[model samples]
Target: MGQQQDDEDREFDIKWADGAEHKEPSARARMLAARWKENPPGPVPFRGEPEGVGPRWSSWVSTAVVLGSVVAVIVLLGYVNFRAPY
Candidate 1:
């Protein structure tokens, strides 16, 4: 097990070379800022609930709630129509 862990660690090890200068993002940053000044971004897009990242019970609860509301609406409408005397 220790050997396997060592192999995994080796696989993720980073080897940085000498004398590598990190480039700045000033150019792209200025360009995006200018574009935003001209045409600002609209409302944030709605990314629906992320998959597989919440309580399993919460999903089942929401689904049951929605179905229960639909059934309740149908039953209420039927009761109302039956009592309408039309």
Candidate 2:
């Protein structure tokens, strides 16, 4: 049996050499970290739940509202400036 080396082991300062020097993690630490590399804690875990509309839908709705308001204002302004023939 032999210890495996991990590739994604990031740089980290750990006590070493009688606590005199601080530098990158040793091969042992890197190897240990690699074991959990596949499942690191960071990204939001998907809690079992039915998915629904996300941020994309929210942005689209807001944009549509703003565009509608602008168009309405422009039409009202033009109507006021040029009234229908009496």
Give residue 24's lDDT in candidate 1 (0 to 100). 49
Among these predicted structures, which one has the highest lDDT? Answer: 1
lDDT of 1 by residue, 17-60 (tens): 22346744689898999999999988865875667888457788
Worst 10 residues of 1 by lDDT: 11-20
Error of 2 at 79 (Å): 0.7
lDDT tens digits, residue span 1-86, model 2: 12222322221222233466555788998987997698676666676434784535578899999999999999999998789665
